[model samples]
Target: SSVMVELVGQMKDNLLLDFGEAKKIIKEVVNVFDHKFFINRKYLKQEDDSHFQIQFEGPKGMFELQVPKNTTYLLEGEATVENLSSEIIKLLAPKMPSNVEAVGVYIYEGYNKGSHIISNISR
Candidate 1:
């Protein structure tokens, strides 16, 4: 979910010195995630001038959580990668409804191994 999205943003930020480099950095990071997470920009129906955007799964891995689509801010500091994943699981586990859907798991590989753990809701 947001974990990947935020992580992608972080990757983009860490490698990019300015907006001009965002695209390159984003593509590089997405490749590591195997193109699972992607940037999304959506119009917010609640506010005409607002928008709800995110970088969630695109193809590689799918989400299995049942969190209601709400803008919840996740922490990004002082927590180990595994701990962060645990935190996200804790927050989302209770919300997971028993049904036909894939379960959540951290995408591992390269530096993306455990640093940017993430989850998402699926249809």
Candidate 2:
């Protein structure tokens, strides 16, 4: 198991939706791991609620979910990257809004320096 990994999802457009949706999607992803992962919501009041993030930690590892105004959503941190990365796209793809045009999954091997773009989703 790697010490760190992050699973990220990107949205296509400027989405004005409820935070609940993001949280729900994240919870679903975490549930599949069958590991104890904790989530903390942050960046609520920054830039007119345009920036939102969720930090996750557990026995497997730790990762963060970041949603900014320009970008849809990004999940990154330290964990077993491969399984989590693919699962994120598989699970979140159906539920995303139409405005969310594309979603990509990247797996960072070893340290942050050793990484590659695994796949791209074009909507």
Which has the greatest TM-score? Answer: 2
Among all windows of ten consecutive residues in candidate 1, which has the lowest summed lDDT? 35-44
Backbone clash tally (model 1): 2
For each candidate in the order shown, give its overall lDDT on alpha carbons.
Answer: 0.37, 0.48
lDDT of 1 by residue, 1-123 (tens): 223322222223345235444345444533433312222223212322233333344387643332223332223433244544545544443333333122243634355345444444453
The Cα RMSD of model 2 versus the native structure comes to: 14.8
Model 1 misplaced stretches (Cα beyond 4 Å): 1-78, 100-102, 107-112, 115-123
* Top candidate, metric lDDT: 2
Against the true structure, candidate 2 has what lDDT? Answer: 0.48
lDDT for predicted candidate 1 compared with the true structure? 0.37
The clash count for each model shown is 2, 5
